[model samples]
Structure formats: C-alpha cells, structure tokens
Target: MGRHSLPDGSAPASTGSRPGARRRTIAISTGLVLAVAAGSVVALRSDLLPFGEPCDGQSVRLDVAASPDIAPALDAVAKTAREGAARTDGRCLDVKITPRPAHEIADAFGQRPVDPEFQVWIPDSSLWVDRVDAGSGTPLTTAGTIASSPIALGAVPEAAKALGWPKKTYTWTELTEAATTDDALRLGVADPARSATGLLALARINAANAKDTKDGDEADTRTAAAAKLLYQRVADGDGQVLATLPRDDSGAEQGNPRRNQALLLSEQAAYAHNTGEDGGPDLDLFYPQNGTAQLDYPYTLVDDDETTPAQTRAANRFLTLLSEPGGQRALRRHGFRTDNGRPDSEVVDAAGGREPQPYSADPADPPSVKELQALLGMWTVTVQSARITTVVDASASMANPVPDRGGQSRMDLAKNSLLQALATFTPEDEIGLWKFATYLDGNKDHVELSPTNRLGDRDKDGTTHRDALAAAFGSLAPVPGGATGLYDTTLAAYEKACGAYASGKFNALVIVTDGANDDSSGIGLDSLVGKLEKLADPKRPVPLIAIAIGAQADKSALDRIAAPTGGSAHRVDDPSQIHQVILKAIMAAGSKGPR
Candidate 1:
C-alpha cells in the first residue's frame, strides 16, 4: 500500500510530560528531520547522536520505522517499554518508534547507501519488504507479524442490505458487475498498483473473472473488462475513498450517498471511519465470498552491515515484547487483529457488538509476483492511460459496404468502432493516427496522419490533435486502386512506435485491417517476422496488436506477424464487438515481448 502519512501531518503525542516524554518528543522530531533530509525515514535517533548525549555505554538503542497507521499504537508501546524495557543480556534497551512511508524507505535502500541509524523496519505489507529485497538483494531479518487486518469491501448499509449483506454471500463477479454495469451503484477504489487493499480487491475480481478461462486471451479479455469498469470510479487516494464514505447516522453527514456507494479498504480504516456505527448504512464490512487479502504487519530487522549484533539482540527482545498478550491488546486498540488473525473482542465491541465473521481468504490467495507483474502491465495500458499508434487499412476493400447494415461501408463501421473504442481511453493517453495502402504516400505504403501526441494537444495552428484526428478519420476515402500493404506497413508502424516511444507510458502499435498483404513491393511474411523478432527489446518493448475486421481478413497471417513482437491478433466479424476486442487485445499487449 502507498504510505499513509500521519492524519494531520504531525507526529503522535508524546506518551508523557516527564523527562521520558521530552526525550521521546525529541527523538520523534529528530527522526522526522532525518526523514525529510533523506527523503526516507530511519525512526528514533540513537542517543549517540549530537556527539555527546549522556547515555549508558551498554544501552542498546534500536530505531524502528513503522507504517503510519500503526505507528502511534507502536509508539504507545514504546513509551511503556521505556520505564522498564526489555534487556539484552543485562544491557538496558531503549526502543524508539517513528512513522515512515514504506515506499520512500524502500526507494532509499535501492538508490543510496544505507544509514546505520535504522535497526528495524515494520512496513504494513510483506509486499513492500519483497520489493526492497528484490531491488537491494540484501536479505531482511523478519520476526513474523505483529498484527494483521483483512482487506474487505466497505459498503453503506443501504447498498449492503440491498445486496443481502451478512445474510447472503456475494462473489467478486457480482460486486464488479454491480459497480461497473449498474448505474445506481458506484464503486470507488484507490489505484491498485499503489494500494495493497486495492491490489488484493482487484486480485479477487480478476480471480473471479478468469475462473473458467479456456484460453489465455479469453482470461485476459475478461480481466480487462473488469479492470476498465472499476478504473473509471477510482479516487485519487485511499483516504479520499474513505473520506467520501458516508458516516453513521447520528444524523451526521458521512459521505455522499449518491457518490460513495462502495469502497475497497482495510478493516482498520473502516473501523476508524465509522467508529460509532453498528450495522448501519454508513459502514459495514463485507468479506467477499471469493476470499480476500490481509495486511500482515511484519517486524523486519535490517540485516545489513550497518546493523550490529547488539542491535539484532535488542530487536529480538522487542519482538518478544510485542507478541506478549499485553502488546497484542495494545495493537488491537488500533483495529488490527491479534497475532493469530482473530479480531480482538474489545475491538469488535468498540466498532459494534457484532464480531466480524471469518471468510475464505486462504493464505495463498494473494497474487504471486509473476501474476502481479502481469496485472500491473495490463493496468498500465488498459486502466491507466497509454501512448498508442493506431494504424488503419485504407485499401479498396475498406470501401465495401457492410453485408447487412443499410448502406454503411466497412470504412464507416470501422471509423465509428474506432471512435467508440477511443472513448474508453483517458484524454491523457496520447494517440497518433496512420493510414495504409499501396502507393498511398509517395513510395511508402503507410502515411502518418498526425504525430503521436496527446489528443487535446495543439500545434501552432491552434487545432487540437483530437479534433484533427477525428476529422482525418471522417475524411478517409479508400483508394480505389489500392491493395493491402500489411507487411511493409506493419514494419513501418513498429519503427515509428519505437522511435517515438515515451519512457513513462505504455507504448504500443494497434493495426486494424480487413485483408492480408497484397503489395508486390512489400517484404515477404518470413522476412518481416525475422526483422521484427530481431528488433524486439524487452527493456524498451513496443507491443503490436493486429485487429482483423472481417471474415475475409487473414487471421493466420496476422497472428504470425504479431507473434514476433510479443503481441496478439484478434478477429472480429461484427463491428459492434470491436470495442470489446480492442480492450482484450490491449490487455494482452506488452505482456509477452522480449522478456
């Protein structure tokens, strides 16, 4: 999950007003200073700082950085620990806890030298630990989890009751469809790529979508549809989603009933949001019937050269303290489960009298690393905006009238379908236009109608690229003497995509054609495939998707051409299905190139 900073951008209150509180206050403030300076955090400065602080030489100071949401609770524990804290072989231990965003610390470790001040780190999810380990190649020593919170669907009582919540079990498919297809229900989520809760929720949705997949493309297509539907309603951040939620009816204004219909959030967040609610329309946690993902707040010790054996022993002592019954109770006050994954009775009573029932979240339900990478790649192109070069066939065959539609030509249907498909893309997504046929642009088989750029962008002439591209689409007239130039045009398009690939965007080439190569001057299929394979680069991938528009379209030839670039080819006989086909193709694109 992305880091949740302190609510007011201020550190937690000092546990006491005595000398110990003052000492801790300085430590917290100093830790924040270091975090600001480093663009990361190593919480709780050691007494050795300032070069002359009075401290017992035998005292072990362990600096611990914790997730923001749980930091304060941990801070409280640290305060109690100070009076008579755990000892390592008769040596006094001073444990300090500071709130830090896990992402920044991970980035710091990957990009810079490690600071010796930080002895232990406790990120919200194991996923963040894995990310740092993968990047740094330095193993982290972890003492299991301190607390856990299951990711759940938070819905207003009205919506939950309407769906038979508590009384009925609902699958992720039903929730996804309701949020995406139903006009009345709005599903809001944070960006899955950034939020663990959102990522897990999406995993459930994907699992439900791909349950009966007979082939990879079918699975990709289904998952894409689900992602696209949910992407539309996402808020900018997790807090925003929580903030929009309706409050309990103490006659208080919670969230917009019209806007905040359902949300994907952690149980801790839900409890914090609806503190006084009891099965009301404002806050009800629904553990999906399909299962869920939990955030296991693992206590990890940094096992690098910077860490000493003394600090390691101190970390072990602290871990033992956190797992004790008293420590578990303190963590439960923050809405996390006990070490064993069961809700604390006090916590259950505090939220309401009803204890949250156990659902089917098998430990392995969370996506594997490979699955996560694929999903993230798909999200980049389909849900998030992308940079795409669209190549359309403008050969004589494109001018043929549709078989059944009144008087609509293949070009007419194709243009309309392409425009409709464009509607699914965000304005931030840059798209360029190209048209192809034999001898269409001097000696070239394809002509660039507009440079690959954002749609709403303007030139010196003040004409918007979107308007210009739409006009270009409207004005296209199939060349009467033209023949399909599939191989040459595809090669040219791929070159253009590569030359203009934006580093941050999902760059791709989308080709829509109604026939196979017929150009005498174009290279043969064998030569084209070999050339494309040689040009393919995983580091700078440019996936090519070929869309065959009719029965006469050559699927085998298109598939063979697309195979070399880790792209895919799809055939759609009906123009109405073009939108769905385009979505599916985009999901599968860029997922299988050089790497």
Candidate 2:
C-alpha cells in the first residue's frame, strides 16, 4: 500500500519540536517574475504535473519520478512549489513528481530509453538504484537520503504477546519456525522478486540460516532449505501475501483465514493501518534482534547525455527547496522522518506517545546482486509444487555392488533412495516410474511401470500407482549382460514430459543413470542435444535432470543433454550420499525459466 495523505489534509505544518529543526519556513518561490514570450505567459501542460494544472509563468521544468507510496506527498510539494512560482536563475521553477512503479522503472533503465524529461528519481530504497546500475552499467549519483523506513513484522496483539515480541526479542529463525513448524502461525509476506520488504525479510532469514552453517555449498544449501520453507508457506496458502491483503477495515477475522496472524510490512505501513480509526486490530511491531532491512528512500540524480545544463540547474534548485523547512515539513506531514533519521512530531503523535524502535544505522548487509539472483531462482522452483517422471537405468551395470557397501547392489540402493525422496514431496506432487534396459519388455528397452498421476493415488485400473511403482522397483532385476539404452529412453521421456506439461507446476523428467549410452541403433549425442534444444520452450519448460549414480557414469554426455533443457548433471560416487544428490537434482530440475 502507498503512503497515506495527512488526516487533516493540510499543507506542510511546522513541527518545531522535532530534534534539530533546520530553519523556519521560507517560501522560495514567492514574487517570481513571469517569463513572458510575445507578451504572453507560457502555459504548462496538465499531463506533466501529477496533480494540478500547469503553472502559467513557469519556464524551467524539472521532472521527478517517485515510488507510489510517497508520490502523494511529493505531488503536494510540487503543487505548492508551482503555486509559489519558484524561480531558478531567471525563470520560474516547475517541479513535476510523477508516480511510477519501482520495478517497471528499473526494467526500463536497461531495456528502454529513459524519458528525456526525467531529471531525478526517488525510489523507496537504494536497492532499485543498485538494480538499474547493475543492469545498465550506468552510474547513478546518489543525491542524498530522503526518508527512512524499516521492514518489520506486524503481528496482531494476541500473536505478538504469545511470541513475546515487545517484551523479548526474537530472531528470524524463531519467527520462521513458529510460522512454519513450531505452532503453525499463519505468515504473510510480499513476493520477494517484486517487494523490497519481502526480499529483506527472506534475506534476513537466509543470512541467519547461513551463519549457523559452515561457509561454502553447505551454507548455500542450508539457506536454500530455509528459504524453501518460507516459499512453501506462501505458495500453499492464498490471501496471505501483501498483494492479496484484505481490504475490510475490520481486518483478518472475517476477511481471510490466511491473513489471521503475523504479516511482514514496512514500519510506516503498520503505523498507518494501526492509527486509522476503526482499524482492524492492534498490531504490535516485532523488530528482529539481528537487525532489519531499511528503505532509505534514496534521492538519485539521473545523469545522462540527454539532460541539458539548464534542466540540471533547475533540478538542483528543486532539491535544495525540498531540504528547506517547508519541504521537510511536507515530508514530515506524510509520516516520513527527516534526512537525519529523526521522526517528526506528526509521526510521534500518531504512534500514541510510543517512540518508534531505533535500529542500527548500518544494518546487516543485503545479499549481493548475484546472491539475490540465485535466491530468486531457488524460490521460483520451490514456490510451485512439482510434477516429475523418474526414469531409472536398469542395465546390467545396475547389478554391480557399491565399492563401499558390502553386498548391496547399486539397483537396490537406487530404489531405496527414490522411495526416501518421495517423502520430501507433498502429497499434491504427481509422479510416475519407468525403467530402461536392453530388451527389458518385448524388445523394448524402456517401459513405464505406472502412469503419471498424483502420488498415493489410484489410477483407472483401481490400483494405487504408489503401490504399483514400489512393487516394480522391488521386483526388478538386471537383464542378463544387458547394455544401456540411454538415448532412446531419454528422447521418449522428454517427449512424454513435454506432451504432459502441467500449468502452474514445475514439470520435469529425472533420469538416474549408471553408465554411458552403448546403443548403436539410437540417435547420437549431438543429434539428441540439438533436438532437445529445439524442443525446449521458455514459456513452458520441462527440464531433464540427470543423476549419475557411480564413478564410471558418463558425466560429459549427461551435461550435454541437460544443458539444452537448463538442467544439471550430478555425479555421486558414494551411494550413501544419494539423498543430498537428489535434493540437488530437484533444484536443477525446476530451474529453467526467466531470470
């Protein structure tokens, strides 16, 4: 939700009691000489200004784009600045504060040319600036910090009291546990890919989980696991995310079951909702003890060749005016703090005499761009339930005993691991089983044991696919001196997966192999990869993940096949580590969409 307008709907008021008041209100635009051409005042366009009609005498125009939350206040400031006929050098200063979606603006910086008139952009946080800078390779100058808001947990008073939020501090782990496992507390958050607040909350959780493990892949794995749980909670429920918040003033109780507990939101948002008359419920703020992400409303200058020197001067003057008492007053009236991070009297009064919690100016560092990219990728996979077809290699090599295990065949271990992996999946996940070996069934190397359907579910034959698959796995034995028929089986499985692509689910094919392709009658590696590449669709992806179970497996060939479908190939020499290897395969299986 955007920032709320002042309750009284008044102009910028003087908050003299604020700590370190800058100066008395000064009207910088009064008594300005009109710039006339042909003895007529130049009329401005209504579309340029977000709110009022254009100023008649204004000559110099400065365009400012701000996030929607603060757009109202900035628009009010611009209107006041225009009414005063503010002057820079010898012409009237006209400021236009256009409201824009933060994500759209970041995307435009890299894919489209920025509008020529925009001189400054004030996004809700420096994160947007970082995104643009990283994407376009253009350096944006940070003018200064305009306002400060921290992401915090907004819990109903009852829930807050149960968690001892205000009385005792809690870490993100504790909070996540309560929401996911400890007590099944409903948790609501925004989509991290789109919401800075959501991203910060998830980042905090990931960092905490990372700190508890040794650095390297172990740390990444732990963080990914924790983030997976967070994503699952949101994915499995509806009406709990920020985008779907209930609109009723009475709030969660007659609104939606998903939103009846703690929600993640910015400090200003929580205060605005709580202070409103007849607002839903009393929300207690929970500030994590390990620190939180702050939105420092970065005032950034858009430096490009298209901007003229005169427009630059006008922009600089507009910023200067905003720093003045009147400009700061407008900001304060809208529940924003001064540039120095001190809340104005208006905010304090709205808080019912309670002071906003102070947080470390230097909070825990946010994830790097690369780390964020990886995290988002992981979330994309785990957020959706999956549909998978497991294709197992039952060639003669499967009968080989594990080098470490005394007598267990590789096939036996693989079968057990597959069963264990099923426990990791929710009942909603759909799965099927297949086996490939030379001349296994009526001269066919590959044959399906069960049809693709929801696990633990009965098919048309009145037999549960789960039981059928388990029976098939337990009874399978290596064909006498059989060879691997990898190419034909993989091609057929890929076709089946593509044909059965399910919407709103991660659809994939998992191939568990023990050796290289030895079938001379089938398509070659190059031809198979080319065909897979051509068949793969970004809009409806079906990645083919391959797990090589032992040391002698052909990893290079598997990589070639998986690369075309945006999947990965994993090699595990130790059969005991198959569980971890399957987790890796699951991540790789669903990783084939947009960045």
Candidate 3:
C-alpha cells in the first residue's frame, strides 16, 4: 500500500494556462517547408489531420494532446494525413488538437482522468501512462510512435574514440568505472523531473548497478552507489557536467562542453543535435554493446470511456495502423524498426533500429496498477525521511506571533503544521518533537511512527505506529525552555531517534530551533556530522532532516548535515509559513533516489 498525505514537491500543480487556442505539440521532424520560404523548418514536423464524421458513421472525436515536453511530430503526422494516408477504414479522419503544458499534463492525471470521451490521449511515452494511472481516471488508451532510444553514449568523436566506442563496445559497467576513474568525462541526460526519458535513464543506470542481484527489493547497493555518484556531482559544484545530465541532453555538449551543465537532454534532441546544421563535432551513438534494455512503448486501446463500441473500435483501428506494414515502414523512415528484426536484418545500424524483445511490461502482464502502486510506495519512503528533533522558541521573548494559517501564533502554527504533516504517513514515517528557549522537558527527542489502525495494520502488535507518534507530538507542551542544542540535538537524533531506521527508509535528523545557534560551533558541528555520516541507515531506516523555526538554529550545522545526507535545514522568518514549507520540503525529500 502507498502512503497518504501528498508531499509538496512530488508534483507542483500547474500555475495557469498558456494563451492561444490550445494545440497539441507532437515531436515531428521536418516533412516539408512552407510554400513561401521552404526554409523555416526548424526540426520535427508540425501537422494535424482535420476531423470529420467517422466513415463508419461513428462520431468519435479524439482530442489529442501531445506531451508538451516533447517536440511535436504533429507536422510529420499531419503531412502524412494530408496525403490521405491517415484515413480511418478507407475514409476521412476527424480529431481535435490542443496543447497543454507538460507539467499540466502530469497534474491533470493527478486530479481528473483524461476525458474518456476522447478516443486517445498520447503522452510521449507509455511510462507516463503508468504515472497518469497512479493519479486519476480508469486509465485511458495510450500509444507511442516509437519507444525511447536505449541509453547510449552521445559523445564527440574524440570522446567516443577515447572510450573505444565504434571500435570497441561499452556496457553500463564500463561507463560507471570510467567515470569513477576519470572525473572529467561528461555524461548527458535530461532532468529527471522535467523528462520521463531522463528518469528512465537513471532507472537504467540503477538497474545496471543492481544487476548483481535480482532480489525483488525496493532498493539495492547499486542504486545507492548511483545516487551517491549523482549527488556528489551536484555537491561538487558544476564540475560533474560530462559525467551526468538528464538522459536526453547528453549530446554534442549542448554547445557548451567547455562549461558543464547540470541537466541532460532527451535522446531525440541528442540525435538531432549531432546531426543538425550546426552539428559537426563528430557525434556517435555508442550503444552499450553488451545487451542494453529497450523501452518498448506499447500502444494500448482504451475501452472504458466510450459512448458506443464504435468509438473504441476506431481507437483500436489506430493501434492497428501503428503496427501494420505501412505503419512499420513509416517507423523505419523515422529511425525505428519492427522488433522482430535482428541486428542482422534490414534493421539499419542507425538511430532506432535493433531486434525487438519482450519488455518487462505488458498492459495486462505486469499490471500497470501494480507498478503505479510500487512507484507510490517507493515515493513514500522518500517523503517522511526524517523527524526533526524540533526545538521551538517558547521563552518570554518568543511569545510574540507572526501571520499563520488564519492568524495564529507562529509557535502554535508550527505545532499544528507539524501535526498535519505527521498525519501524512503510513506506520512507516515518523517524527520527534521538542520545545525550547529557557528550559527543555516533556518527552523531548521522542519519535513516533504513524498509526495505521484504520487499515488494521498492527505495526506494534496492535497499536499503529502513527498513533504512537501522534501521541508523542501531542504530548509536546510548550515548557519554558532556552538555549537550543542546534548541533548537539541533531547529533543526538543521529544516535537517539533516526538511527533506528537508517538502513530501511530515510531517517533524518531535524531541528526546528528559533533564530541562530547559541553554542553549536564549527568544531562541535564537525564532530556531529562525522558521527552521522559514519552511521549507515538501519536495515530500512528513513532519511533525516533538520528545520530551524524562527531562528535559534545553527544554520551552518543544519545546512552541512542535510546536504550530504539527503535532508535540508530550512529557516523560517515567519512562523505561520511553517506548515506549507515543511510539507514542500517533505515532497522534495521524496524526489531523492534511494539513500
């Protein structure tokens, strides 16, 4: 089962709609130039087939929206349709087109189901279908023109030559080992958050690392090693550019191999870049020679939301077109080949050709519902990572308040917000509470897990861990306290609370002290960090984090600990903003790859 309480960063809601009549943006290559200039074709075609009454008399209006994140192949598809090749059942075609922001599409699935009335909603990849299913709707029909290019090295001729590419071959192990030895090499990919392709690239790397053992587990040593490699590159400033990029942008150096970039680009962009007009840096796609994984973007027909059987039938017809001989021929023109072809067949040794193999996915085989559930489950471990050994300012000087949710004391607001956030848990995520300024007492440093009694999950023989944790938070009385243990408390939690679950889930050391630090100096903080770092997580410990509420926190200390350990030390000028901010941070924590 997945955890409750949506964390903030998991997926930011769409802010607003773009101006203009919405048009679907499909990734298409230039089919032809406009009659006037014949030179404005940038890259990818942009065309849409006109809609009309279905030849079979079925009024199936498919409002197609391409994932705005990917370049629209609309023009390519449109040009084909204009040639009368897109007719359904040997007649005209009818469909409306609209373009929504990429983020909006991710959000849409979270809120409402794609209109079942619409015959089909094609995102860039079928993997997105998995994410969309995780959210709303009785999943709709999804299809893709081509699956992603299995990740390969998109390097300059020199880089490829140096790696023994076209001459030799590369396996994931070769790449990782090379990076470990030579720190200057760059690997490209798109931002995981921005592009599903990048995320897949990351997953592939993780799986490659995980190949040693196929134990059906959530995380493995290889994944942790890969994440550490990524984070180190991030912490090492912008120096790790060539080593890591989103899976997509790892191409001809993004016109700046001189100055490394943080994110990667999509494989299509990488291909286009190496072959573009300004593209002569000697580019090559080094397919890892030893059995690489291909993303099989299977197109499935949605039958759940149709008025009549004809509309559904029409949708299936489209699927048929995608797999038929003509469609397969079109796929080859766009650099794809039918899966059956071997590296030996007419499968031109080019961008999108290779033998086809059965993917670990099937609309019915793997059960998307189960995968969606798994994604959410892994996500929960990321969010409730650490329970801050929160130390609120309760002294006489701290009594004044700031604006909070509906105007409440900053301290009280902080308490309520923390309570609400704690509520977003499965017996797995837990937190600790403390109040301070002059004196500290009353279950300080007490960490409790969320109780899952509602589902009859007996984490503690009969009591839900959440209930136990809730009781701990409730018992946190604002006693007259002073002098927060900025670093010491954090160090304490490393040993005291979070240490218990360090290996299983993310166990963080959180501190919500008021203002600046009083005693936790550099030397003391160093000692604390050293101890925390030395300790690996428990068999399944959650992550740890520290928060500074209304000052009274060792800024430097909190920052350092959270940085490497997958946590954050946040400073709040106004107390009322506590709830939303903490929630947001939790969501960000969810985005981390396993710790």
Worst 10 residues of 3 by lDDT: 8-17
Q: Looking at model 2, which ten-residue stretch has the lowest summed lDDT?
A: 1-10
* Residue 185's lDDT in candidate 3: 60
Off by over 4 Å in 1: 1-58, 107-117, 134-139, 179-182, 212-219, 247-259, 276-282, 348-364, 390-430, 433-446, 449-595
Candidate 3 Cα errors over 4 Å, as ranges:
1-61, 67-75, 89-91, 95-104, 114-118, 135-138, 142-148, 213-222, 231-270, 278-282, 300-311, 340-595
lDDT of 3 by residue, 423-456 (tens): 5444444444544432243434222233112222
Q: By TM-score, is 1 or 3 better?
A: 1
In terms of TM-score, how similar is model 3 to the real structure?
Answer: 0.48
Q: Candidate 1 vs candidate 2: which has greater TM-score? A: 2
Give TM per candidate.
0.62, 0.72, 0.48
In angstroms, give how far residue 418 of model 2 lies from its true place. 3.5
Candidate-wise lDDT, in order: 0.68, 0.66, 0.44
> What's the ranking of the predictions by TM-score, best on top?
2, 1, 3
Sorted by lDDT (best first), the order is 1, 2, 3
For residue 418, what is the lDDT in candidate 3? 69
Runs in model 2 with CA error above 4 Å?
1-65, 84-95, 103-145, 178-186, 210-261, 275-278, 296-332, 336-362, 398-413, 438-444, 459-480, 548-552, 575-595
- Of candidates 3 and 2, the better by TM-score: 2
Between candidates 1 and 2, the one scoring higher on lDDT is 1
